[model samples]
Target: MKHRRLEVFLEFLFFGLVMGITEDLIALKFATGEPLTWKIILIVFLVALPFAIIGELIVDRVRWWRKIRRTFQKHVSSVKSSRK
Candidate 1:
């Protein structure tokens, strides 16, 4: 369990880093009419950071939702009497 947790942590870290760099590059290209270095950093922080955070939160919620669904289904079945 601990090993799996560490692997998930590393995976999310790499994902966030890649997302940040990719967003910075896209922002740089879009800002061709203006300065790049500053725009890249600003966009990475302003756009990518929030996006990653929200994405992670959404994924976490989905996992929780699945768990709750399974539990609710189990409870519903248990409360019903089936002729088996």
Candidate 2:
């Protein structure tokens, strides 16, 4: 259980970092003729953290849903086989 939680956390963090960097880059490109700076990058990274968590939660829920579906299908197939 702990391992699973850790995996989820890592996945979340990775997603967040990617998204944050992407966002920062896009924002920098469209800025009002301002030069990019380390401070701006840092700010974007910080903002991306929460968004990343949210993305992770969404992915995790989808993962759980798929697992449940697979388990259910397996159980149903097993019952049908035993009945024959």
How do the residues 1-84 of candidate 2 rate in per-residue lDDT, one tens digit apiece? Answer: 999988878977896789778877787778756777888778878888777777677755677889999999999999999999
Against the true structure, candidate 2 has what lDDT? 0.81
Q: Which candidate is the best by lDDT?
A: 2
For residues 1-84, could you state the per-residue lDDT of candidate 1 as single tens digits?
Answer: 999976776678569867786867776677775555775576667767666666566655568789889999988888785633
Per-model clash counts, in order, read 0, 0
- Every model: Cα RMSD to truth: 5.7, 6.6
All candidates: TM-score:
0.46, 0.55
Q: Which regions in candidate 2 have their CA more than 4 angstroms from the true location? A: 63-84
| Every candidate's lDDT | 0.71, 0.81
